[model samples]
Target: MLELSPILPIAWLLVSLGFLKMPAYKACLIGLAISGIEAISLWQMDYVLALKATLEGSVFALLPIIWVIVAAFFTYNISLHTGAITHIKQFMSSLSGDRRIQALLIAWGFGGFLEAVAGFGTAVAVPAALLIALGFEPFLAAVVCIFANTAAVAFGVVGIPVNTLAQITELPILPISMAIVWQLAPFGVLVPLLIVVTITKSLKGLQGVWLTTLISGISFGLAQFVVAKYVGPELPAIIGSIFAFLATVLSAKVSPPLRDWKFPREREAAASFAKVQA
Candidate 1:
């Protein structure tokens, strides 16, 4: 029981957020209170030290994480106002009309790139928004984007996460980055396939585009591994995502889907048209 005391706050956070489906602010506040109580009672932490730690953490969140999110939103608004978002949607649509392919392209590939550059939920926010704009159901878009952000997260924001780990552990960044890449590379390959399955909600969804899915995954995983091994952590997500995007686009061109998969709205429209014709 004493040994497990350290994890109680985290467990409470997970339960509150995941099971209770509480608002993030409320969950975090409760979790913070729990942590403070545990520190004071279980760990015998001095009140002053606990207060200092909390202040430092709050400052860290405000300065780096919050600022990055603000900047990303600012950039997004600029892009939207300038009509760049519309052009991006058009360009992605031109790549492939299949919603499955589009999910892989936007959620996996583009989201990875955003994670590499901006991170701090920018990957999730930007990709999900693009997907919704492209006619994906909003909840599904959010879920797919969240899944797609996973593999790229280790090297996100120019490798801040890995660098921070290395700093804390007093280890060389390269070996740490390489090891992380090795571990995550397989998931990088698997996530695209998973995204497709999630979008289509059926095993049969993989039937036509399995090859393209494999191509996107393999290219992303391979490129991430190579870059992390040689070029260090900074470029893996960015370069790997670029490679995946290009590879997916080219392979899709070489072996295009026999019939482009339509979104639910498009399918409904087509059915209505058929009924009218009948």
Candidate 2:
């Protein structure tokens, strides 16, 4: 059974996500039925204990997952019902005409702003869906939003993690911020580059203005260092990403005409362009 813990996860994945060919809801029901029946058959505990375990397991399973999904659908519904989503896309498209810029604005900047507020899956789903609505491919939008959310995860909720660390460690806020930057500065440097690499595939994404990304990373890294060094802990995330985003504008200004630039393969572009035309 000790060994089974990892194996059980594999079996669970196979049933829910693979061979069952069932939707998530149906898979969940099947899993619950299997667990309940197995518990009874194995006589793992007294009936009362089994009942308690079952209830506990269900609550553990549902609460956080349900909270995330409920919050996601709620934000999604707000976008649909209020039409904040429309204005949002207009806001994004107007920011940059390039599809890549649209991805960064909607997924990174806007997504970071939302994550700063909501701190949940809404950060990704809402922005990615917005990008998709604005004519970006779904997968591309998801990838960028995921990258954009990283910068904010550490300090969002008005710097929750720093606050918690300060409280527990009884250290001053600056040191905690310093410690965070120790790990976060590298993470910040990597994400923007990762977004480019993921979208275009290979180092090919770095083809145009690669130095600009490096310089932008330097700007962000310096901002984080300053926030960790002189500025208060509360400001590193918002300030760092803002500086980084602004620095990218330099790349837009300096890079060669994008049409002349090459990506991994021509066939892929033709297929993608065909889809866009369709």
Candidate 3:
């Protein structure tokens, strides 16, 4: 019974948050109450020690995690209000008309940069909004952005996640960051290709743009690996994203997509017209 007591708070949290659809804050408070009670009654913990632990955790979360997220959102909102985001959207749109190329640029490259800088939700939200503005289907844009966000999250928000892990594990930051990048490198290389696949809704989407997509992914993965190995966690995502963006642009210049590929409906219409002509 005592061994199972610790699971009660977690089970209540899952039930309240997942099944009952309670607000996160409320569910957390109730879970905290349950934990406090369990610590005091079941574990026979001293009240002062329990209180001290709770206070320390609350302070740590407030100062490091919550404040950082708040600051990131604040910066994003300021950019939005000042029309900087509009200019950025315009700049991205001007880069390429091919939807596949644009997906690589915005979702894979720019989204990774956003994760490096602000993180939390900025990477997914900003890139999805840009894709939607570029005439991508809303659902597809969101999905592609979500897919592209996977690997970059390791070093997200100036590497807070990695730093926090190091602190918790009492490990050196450099080795931890390097190991994380090494593990994530394959995913980093594949996520860009996956984003393209998601955006096009078919493997045929890689028809002509496969080379460019591969270049973007390789550049991103290689840059991240180098930075994480030599520099640290804070700069890997940022440097990797920049390298990916520049490499994609250069590759496109040298060997652009063989044909301008749009969404499924547009491609079908073009195919039908070609068939009629033939």
**Winner by TM-score between candidate 3 and candidate 2:** 3
Task: List candidate 2 stretches off by more than 4 Å.
Answer: 1-22, 26-94, 254-257, 260-278
Q: How far is candidate 3 from the true structure (C-alpha RMSD, Å)?
A: 5.9
Kindly give the number of clashing pairs for every candidate: 0, 0, 0
Number of the top lDDT candidate: 1
Worst 10 residues of 3 by lDDT: 68-77
Q: Per-residue lDDT of 1-278 in model 1, one digit per residue for the tens?
A: 67998888899888998899999999999889988998999889999999999999999888876776567567667878999878878888789989999999988899999999977677887788778777888889989999998898878689888888889999998999889988897897789889998988987898789999999988998898888888888999999899998999998899999989876779999999999999
Q: Write candidate 3's Cα lDDT for 168-235 as tens digits.
A: 99999999988888888789768887887777778988988899999999999899888988889899
List all candidate RMSDs to the true structure. 2.9, 5.8, 5.9
TM-score per candidate: 0.84, 0.66, 0.68
Off by over 4 Å in 3: 1-94, 267-278
Position 130, candidate 3: lDDT: 68
The better-scoring model by lDDT among 1 and 3 is 1
Pairs that collide in candidate 3 are: none
Inter-residue clash pairs, candidate 2 = none
